[model samples]
Target: MSFKTKEKEAVGVPISESWEIDFQDDFDTFNTENWQDQRIWVNNETHCYVPDNKYGTREVSDGTLKLKVINTGAQKPCDNFDKNGVQHPDTQYVAGRITTKNKHEFIKGKWTARLRLSSNGEPSMFPAWWLLGAENNESPVQEANENVCWPLTGSGEIDIFEHHGDHQKNHYTTGAIKSLGECDKGDWWSLRKGFDVSLNEYHEYSVEWENSDLVYRVDAKEVYRNVGQGDQYPEKMFAILNFAKITDAPMKGEWVMEVAWVKHEFRK
Candidate 1:
């Protein structure tokens, strides 16, 4: 399938005159000042996030950001371990993960991105574009947090788009996670009709956050809406893009998630 080019105008739900573009990236090049190359591991993932281009972690070319998952036969030492307390002497896979942790953040706005994921169905390759509250304990922005744990207090998570390679060609998921009773039991909320997005074609995924509700859309079409739980996410959040290896699906070479651009507009 052919790739789609970037659009000249913003392609999302029409904004009122009061809304203004606050943050945008066409990805003409890798802007180090706006994104951090996160290398820490979590969630029992198999790949180690690295900044090296040779490992197929991050690449910017022709106005696009390519976050790739690659297999390197050589064993690379890693300091982090999974829940089982098993140390990873050497990792066979390396991938990309970048976040706007200490850069740009917003409380209520319209966040959107245009991207296409790798069509490789290896079940292990997981690609996602999501947001996390700036006050999260793991947040690189130290000033935003006041000793708060994850998914509670000032920390929340919003999954704008996520794709599992094992699913159908046009299947994906989007949802929100809210803290409940100190993160011990959080609520996982999702759309009634989960996302069915084409893997090889570019599409726009977005969330319109307001005081009253959170509306999720794909290509400007409303897919889901949450009205009552919007108050739980009062703190500002930052963006994250990554491709992780989470399963035993045998991988041959590489998997890529190409991003054309990302934008955030807020109401004045």
Candidate 2:
């Protein structure tokens, strides 16, 4: 794996600049080394592993991470597996979702990931690039179960991106901040007209944050922005790349999420 950093100034915004982290895993060098480092704590404690149900397994082949939602009957364990081998049936088919806990945490910065989303005759496939918090208090079970302690009303969550296959050409991304015993929120956007169904090409989705502001983008174009919105924004949060299933959808199906890389950079 090779790491390349590039800095460029935005064409129209004179003071605005951007930096990119390029990881060309042409030889799968980073698969075992850096990939493990990027796994987030939230996913780890939640038993989110590869090749599960909605989430699956991702293999490093041909210089890219091929995320497949497969149904092999092997009982995959959560990040914290016990010796009893007691399987969490609720977490079956949970695969291919990675977070940034038990490793590094970012306070405020820009995060972007490149991916190719696909559907496999499965109707409820949801491929998303979003952000969620790491429940870092009390027992792992209590932390994951917001209703048991924090309650859903006060639990903080910031979903930067979410798109479903059923909503062809109409996807929305959300952001939420919990404070004052309440959760403040922002409106969603309707940006989904330029997607190609071939599912073989790459697309970049990014979220930029600074202080109490945030901007979400697709294919490098700004889609949603919140200024003075959602409880001063998320100071420290982790991003997620997942292809999930819509349990309530009329038709049920499966999907795969393939990714090139996820990059993060700060403005100076």
Candidate 3:
């Protein structure tokens, strides 16, 4: 296994004033006009994605959005299903996943979210801040144009922040996922980089196009760059926030990822 990461540090990116905010949500409340709960299984992720804050899996308070993974301690019936219409098994874990799929999809802009975990990373916790192509053909396919499958023309993905708690605390990986020209065929580690950061505190995670290249940042500071890979994701995309339980290991209490805000910016 080869490594595709950089040492965490600020490399400096010139602040551009020519950009203006295009969309924003400060999480004054869980506004259905801008987002919707997404309950589909794809990653083999262990927890069931639930809606309506069932078991306190999602909450908005103090002007922030909290996506949580709650341990119910016993199996509960789940309504989440896969793309093939197979229902998820009754689960001991329930979590929240939200997306802007049909609400705020846009192309060629800066995406940013200020968020943090409630505690140090622990086993099985998988929290993410990312974007998926609007035309993705997963469950809840809402339109005729939304038929593109994964890693294809309109289904490419970009992860701005992902923490694999099974690895280490205070760390995350961010970058564009390279498409391999077929459904579900994508290179996840090629253009991505894992970085050390304080997970228990808020930091702005972001990805923006620097011409044809892609720039990844933490708190408005550049940390990594994937040269000329931005061309693969030209389709409109939308944001997502979710806390997943990815392993069978039992954990105490619950895990939380808090978001202060999410926004997009475009050239003026």
Candidate 4:
């Protein structure tokens, strides 16, 4: 689990000539100049293609997009946690989750998200910035391989910011490229210890994905970098922004995640 602390000299890869740089901008200055409103946003309605789960919503205030979810008086729904220990509850306890699904999708480029998140000291709460393949879905499959997806087949999945409430100072970040028929795969890495994450401050989580390599970073420091080669790597994917409370049953406390913005840029 190397943190990619070694600065290597610039290296290049060979790819199709059609691939070119798409977007390049500095959002640190704060301007709405080139930002495009996502095509899909959270609504009360349920759809077949989008996630209609209990705990996510999008709002607007002072020209900013605010996404939040908190547990209320609802009983926790079962079927939230899987065998791998991933929480997938049907009802939310005290958190919110959002994604740029129908609203936005990336084919291949450097994807960056600027966000602020917190466990808020509530147990079983996980906050993350992750991505999944749009083609990989749970609905009735049109074909066998047609429905197969990344984490499902161990294709290419990246978890940018994942925090457990039990540990407040550090978080876990992972990226893997599934191999050997989705069974054999790559590795994952956790961030350095003693990394203090303030509850209300903004930080940057980023992934630089190229032809056969992916790099994960936090606040400009590279934590994990995997140089992979194969078709399991994702050529395109979408982003998810969420802070969720995990409960075996619906119990309550305090947990929240605030996102400032998300940006993606590429240079060849």
- Candidate 2 per-residue C-alpha lDDT over 41-136 given as tens digits, one digit per residue, 9 for 90 to 100: 232222235432234265566666665444444456545332233433334444465444433446557777777765433445556666544443
lDDT per model vs. reference: 0.77, 0.48, 0.88, 0.49
Candidate order by TM-score, decreasing, is 3, 1, 2, 4
lDDT of residue 263 for candidate 1 = 89
lDDT of 4 by residue, 1-268 (tens): 2222122222332333222445433334323343322212111211111133233334434434444445455545433333234444344343434554444557656677666654444555556677666554432223354354435442355666666655564445456434334522334443222234564567787777656667777787887766663234544666666654443433354444656667766554
Residue 19, model 4: Cα distance from true site in angstroms = 13
Q: Per-residue lDDT for 34 in model 1?
A: 81
* TM-score of structure candidate 2: 0.62
* Each candidate: RMSD: 5.9, 7.4, 7.3, 9.1
Which pairs of residues clash in candidate 3, taking residues 3 or more apart in a chain or in different chains?
none
Per-model TM-score on C-alpha atoms: 0.86, 0.62, 0.93, 0.61
Q: Could you give candidate 3's per-residue lDDT for residues 1-268 as a string of tens digits?
A: 1121121123332234256788999999999999999999867778888888657888999999999998888988888888778888888899999999999999978999999999757888889999999899997788899999887979889999999988998889998888888888999998988999989988999999888888998998999998988887899999999998888988888889999999999975
| Model 1, CA-based lDDT | 0.77
Supply the TM-score for candidate 1: 0.86
Clashes of 1: 0
Candidate with the larger lDDT of 1 and 3: 3
